[model samples]
Target chain A: MSPAEHLADAGLVQLLTPAGERVDHPVYSPLAAHLDGDALRAMYRDMVLVRRFDNEATSLQRQGELGLWAQSLGQEGAQVGSGHALAPQDYVFPSYREHGVAQTRGVDLANLLRLFRGIDHGGWDPTAHNFHLYTLVIGSHTLHATGYAMGVQRDGLVGTGDPTRDTAVVTYFGDGATSQGDVNEALVFAAVNNAPLVLFCQNNQWAISEPTTRQARVPLADRGLGFGVPSVRVDGNDVIASYAVTAEALERARSGGGPTFIEAFTYRMGAHTTSDDPTRYRSAAEDEYWRQRDPIDRLRLHLEQTDELPAAFATDLEAEAVALGERIRSTVRSWGPPTPASMFDHVYASPNSVVDSERAWFESYESTFAPTQGGAR
Target chain B: MTTERITFAKAINSGLRRALEQDPKVLLMGEDIGALGGVFRVTDGLHKDFGPDRVVDTPLAESGIVGTAIGLALRGYRPVCEIQFDGFIFPAFDQITTQLAKMHYRSQGRLTLPVVIRVPFGGGIGAIEHHSESPEALFAHTPGLRVVSPSNPADAYAMIQQAIASPDPVLFFEPKVRYWDKADVDLETPAEPPHTDAAPTGLDRARVLREGTDVTLIAYGPSVAPALKAAATAAAEGTSVEVIDLRTISPLDTDTLVASVRKTGRCVVAHEAPVLYGTGAEIAARVTERCFFHLQAPVLRVGGFHVPYPVAKIEQDYLPNLDRILEAIDRTLTF
Candidate 1:
C-alpha cells in the first residue's frame, strides 16, 4: 500500500474538538464504545488530579522543598488517557515527565515527590504496580521495554491469543528522544524479535526549546517503517483519542501482533522546566497557536455541550480541587527536611561498612550544621 | 574435597554455573554471553546448559541492561548483568549511578537490590583503545553500591559468588587478561553458601597476597597480578615488599590497610588508572591520617601516565610493569 493509504489505521483514532465539540472520526468507532459517561468522567477526574499534583510538586520546588520538578502541565491528557487504558499486568516504562501516568498506575504521589525532593532515588517499588521507575535519560527506557517484552515472550505470555492473561510492555519517550541512538536501536531490536512491546512517543513539539523539526526529517511515526513496526499518530490533546489509540495498539500487541509506535501529536504548553523560559527560544505566536489545543478545555466543553456535565457537579469538583490544593500546601509545610541518616539505609539490602562509616561521618557533620525538630542532619 | 587445576576462565565459568545451580532466581544477562559465549568465552556453554531464558543474550544497550536489571531485582530475581567491556560501560553510567546505586537507599530498607553488574576490566591485550581502560573508580565512588575485583582464579571463583550473594548492588570487575591464567579450584561436593543474610558484608577490603617487610605494593583489578610479580622481582633486589590486592575499592577497608601500612612503613601504590583521584588517592589520604607516625616516606603511586590509555602499540610504556614498580619500591625505601 502507499504511505498515505495507511494513515490512522485500525485504532489510530481522533475524537472531540479543540473548541469543545464532539466529532467522531471513521477510524475511531471502536474506542467510542469504551468511554461511556462514567469512564469519560473518570478520565477528566484523573486529568484534574494529575494536574493538581504536578502543580503542587512544582510549587514545592519553588518553595525550596524539592530540588527539581519536571512539570506535566499541558501533557496531562496524553499521560492520563493512555495510563487509564492499561491493565494491572501491563508494564509501563515512563519517561521522567509522566507524573500523570505514575499517578494513574497507583504509584504513591508522595513517593514520586521524594525523588525530585532529593530524598530518594525512587521511593516507590516498580514491581508493585508494574510501572517501571522513571528513566531520566532519553530513549534508554525503550530498550528496557524491549527486553521486558522479550522476557514476556519467553514466559509464553505472548502468541497465546489470550487477551486477559497475555501482557505487553509500553515504553514512553518524547520527540527529543527519537534522536537518541538507543531509541533507534530499540526499534530494530523490537522489530527483529517481534517483541510484545508498544513504543509510545509523546511528541510535545519541544525538547527544551529544540522544536519537533529538529528531531525528525519526516514524522517520527514514519521512522518505525524502516524496522517494519506498524506506527500511528494521534491527536494527543484529545484524551479520548489518546486512550483509544493506546488501547487498540496494546490489544494488538497482547494478541501477538508485535510492536507498534504511536506519535501523540501535541504541544508542550508550559516552560521546558521551571529552570527554563520558553519565551527565550521560540516565538510568542507559536505558543499561542498551540494554546488553542489545550486538552482539558475541549473535554470540558464537550461535557458541557452534551449536558453530561451537571451544573452542581462542576461546582462540587471545583470545591474538591481547592481542598486538594490546600491539602497539598499543608503537606508541604508539615514535611521536614529529610534526615541525613536516611542516606545510609538503601545503599545495599543489608549493611556494609562503607555505608556505615559514611553515615556515621555525615551524622556527626550534619549535627554540627543544622538543628531540626527532632535532631541534626 | 579434591583440588583440580583449572584456568581462571573455567573457574569463573564453573563458579557462575554453580551459583546459578544453587539459586533458581539467579540469571545471566549480557551481549553474546548466550550463543556466542563471552568475548573471552568465560561464560561458554552456560546458555546451552541453563536454557536461553536463564542466560539472556541482550541487545547492545548498556543503560537499559543495568536499569531493567534493577527492575528484575525488585521483582525477586537476582540479575547478574554484564557490561561487555570496561570502556563500553559509559552508556550505562546514568542508570548505574542514579538508579542501581540509589535504588536500595531509596526503598528505605523495604527493598533489596541483589543485582550484580560484571565488567571485564583493565588492560593487557593489544586491543583497541576503548577495550583497555580501567573505569572502576567511577563505580566505587558512587554511594549505595559495593565494588569488588578479583585477580586470581580462586578469588574470582570465591568473590564472584560472594558478590552474587550480596544483598546490595555489587559492581564485580573481572580481570579480562587473567581469564586464561590457571589456578587450583575445589570443584568438589558443594558446601553451604557463605553469608546470605542481609548483613552488610564489609564487602570492600584489601586482601594481602604476599607479606613482606620493606615497602607495600598496592593494586587492584588487573594490576594486582602485575603488582605481585613486581613484589617477587623486588625481593630479588633485596627490598622485601608486601603485595596487597585491594579486592574492594569503594569501601576502602581501612583497618586492614592501616595495619599493613604500619607493618611496612614505606608504601608504593600501583594501579592501571591515573594516579590522581584513583583508588590509590583515597587510600593514601586515609593511611596518612591513621599511620602518620609510622610512615617512612610519602606514599608513592606508580600508575598509568596522566593521559588517555595510549594506543595499543605504545601501551607497554603507558602501562606499569615490574621494572617500573621496582623503581617505585626502590624510591620508597630510599626515603
Candidate 2:
C-alpha cells in the first residue's frame, strides 16, 4: 500500500468524512457532543476566515509586499480545531506557519505580516494573549511549551478540578519537526515531569520537500509512546475530529494525566512557502488527492447538509473576508521601514555600556547619509 | 568583613546556595548535579541543601537543559544551567545562540531571560579530549551573550551571584582545573548587598591583580594564574610586569586595559584557547585602536596553537604555561 493508504488504514479518529457526512467515532464522539449548531457554525467560520487570510498573505508575498509567506492552505481544520480547544488562560507556542492558530487566539492579522515585511522580528506580546512569538527554528518551541507546562504544574494550576483556573499548554509543529532532537527531548521532559502539555503535531506529510517516510519509519504518533507520552492519530481534514481529539488531550493534561501527543494526519496543498515550487518534488496526483479533501470545503458541505447554512451568513462571511484582505493589503503597503538605530534598542533589558556605546556609534554613522531627493527624512 | 579561605569549587557552591536563599525562583539544573554534585564538584552539596525541586538533576541532554531553562525563565524563574564540560556545550549550541541569546531582543524587551549557563572550561588536569577544551571565544563572539570567567574563589563566588541577579543571559565559564585552588572569600558580607549606598564592583570591569611599570599582562580564567606567576618571576628579574585579570570577556574591560597599556607602553594577552580568531585577537585589535600612540611595542599574545586541545600528555605544550607567558612578556620588553 501507498503511504497515504497505509495511514488511512491506521485507525484514524475521524468524525467528519470527505463527502461532507458527519460520521461518528466511538472514542471522539462524546468530546464534541456538547457543541451545538451555533458552535459548529463558528468553527466553520473560523476555518474559512483563516484560509482567506492565508491566501491574501500569499498574494501579498507574490506582489512583493512581503519577503515570503508560508501558507496554511490545506491545514486550517487542524489549526482551528486545536486553537478553539484552548482555554483563555492556556498558553500556545507555534511554529512559523501558524497564522490560522493566530486568528483563533485573537492576534491581529496585520501583526503576523510584520515579520514577513521585515518591519520587526516578532510583532506580538505573547503574554498578553497567551500566544508566544512564532519560532522559525523547527521543533525548538516544543521545549519552551513543555517548560511552561512544568511552570504551570509548579504553580498549582493543574489537576485542581477547576475548569476556569486549571491550565494546559499546546505547542504546534509539522511532520518535519518531529524528527528534531529538541522536539523529542521535549517529549522526554514533559513525560518525566508529568507536565500539563499537549504536543500537537500537524503531520502535513512533507517537511518542505522530504516526505514523512524519510523522517519516521513507523507512524510519527508511535514515536511519542517510546517517550512515555500517550499518542493518538486523527484525520486532520476532519475539523470535528481534530477539535474533539485536541480537546480531549488538553482536558487530560489540565487534569494532571501528563502529556498527550496528537498527530493530525493532513497534507500540505501548497508549496512550502512562496519560495518553493511543489511541482519539482511532489506528484500532481497527490495534490489532486488532498484537494478533494480540502478542510474548508468539508466543513461547508457538512453545514449545508444539516440545513444550518443561511444564505445571508455565507454572503456576509464572504464580504468580511474581502474587507479583511483589503485591510491587510493596505496596511502592509503603508508600513514604513524601522529606524536604523532601533535595531540596538532591546539587545539587553538592563543597560550595558557596550551596547550604549555601539548605539551612539550607529547613530553617528547613520547621520552621514544624505536625505533622499523626495525630501522625506 | 569576615574572610575565610576556600576552594574555588566550594566558593561556587556557596554562591549558588546564597542565590537560592536570596531568590525563591532561582533553579539549578544539569546532569548528575543532584547526586554526583557535578563531575567537577563545583555544584557540590547544593542539591542536598536546596532539595531536588530547585537543584534539578535533569535527563542527560544538554539541549533539553538549556532549552527548558529558557522556558523556566519565561515563566519568571531564574534558571542556572550547568553544561558538564566546555566541549559538551556544542550539543546545545543552537539553543544557546539562537534561542537563549536572541529571545530578549526578539521580544522587544517584553521578556528578560535571567538564565546563567555555567560551563567548566580550559585544560591542564590531564583529562580526555572532549573534557579539556576551551570554547569561550565562540560564545563571546555572539552579540547577545555575556561571557565572564573568574580565576579565583572570590570572583567565582561574587560573579556567579551577579550573573544570576542580572536581567540577562550570562555564559559563566568556570576554570575546572582551578576548582581546587584556594582563595579568601568574605562569607559574613554578601557578595552583593541588597541595599548598598556604595557603588558595587560591576562584573564587566577588569581587576589589576599585580601592579607594575614596564609591561601589562592581560589574562582571564585559567590564564590569569600563569600571567600572575609570570609577572612575579619577571619582577624578581627587575622587569616590572603588571597583571590584569579580565573578569568579563564579552563586554571587555577595554578602559582598564587601555589605561594600563598607556601607562606601561606595552601589552601581552594570554589565554588557553587558540590565538587565531580568539578573544586575544579582539583584545589586541581594541587595544591597538585605543592606545595607538601610547604603545612602545605591538600587543603580543600568548595562547595555544590553532589545533584541537590535544590529549592529556601534550596539554602542557598546548596550554599557555608560566614560561610561555613569560616569553611573551620578554618579547614585549624587547621593543
Per-candidate iRMS values, in order, are 3.2, 2.2
Error of 1 at A337 (Å): 0.4
Which portions of model 1 miss their true places by more than 4 Å? A1-12, A19-27, A55-68, A108-112, A115-125, A154-156, A159-164, A365-377, B107-112, B189-203
DockQ of every candidate structure: 0.43, 0.61
Query: Which of the numbered candidates is closest to the native, going by highest TM-score?
Result: 2
TM-score of chain B of each: 0.95, 0.97
- What tens-digit string does per-residue lDDT give for candidate 2 at A1-377? 35665355377899889989978877899998887778878888888888888889999999999999999999999998888888999999999988878988999988999999998898999898899999999999999898888878878899999999999999999999988999999999999999999999999998899988778878889989999899999999888899999999999999999999999999889999999998998899889989999988998898899988899999999998899889988999999888778889888776666788889987787677786643224
Per-prediction count of colliding residue pairs? 4, 0
CA shift at A323, candidate 1, in angstroms? 1.8
lDDT of 2 by residue, B12-102 (tens): 9999998999898999999999978998887788888889888999988899999889888888899999999899999899999999999
Docking class of 1: acceptable
Which window of ten consecutive residues has the lowest lDDT sum in model 1 chain A? A1-10
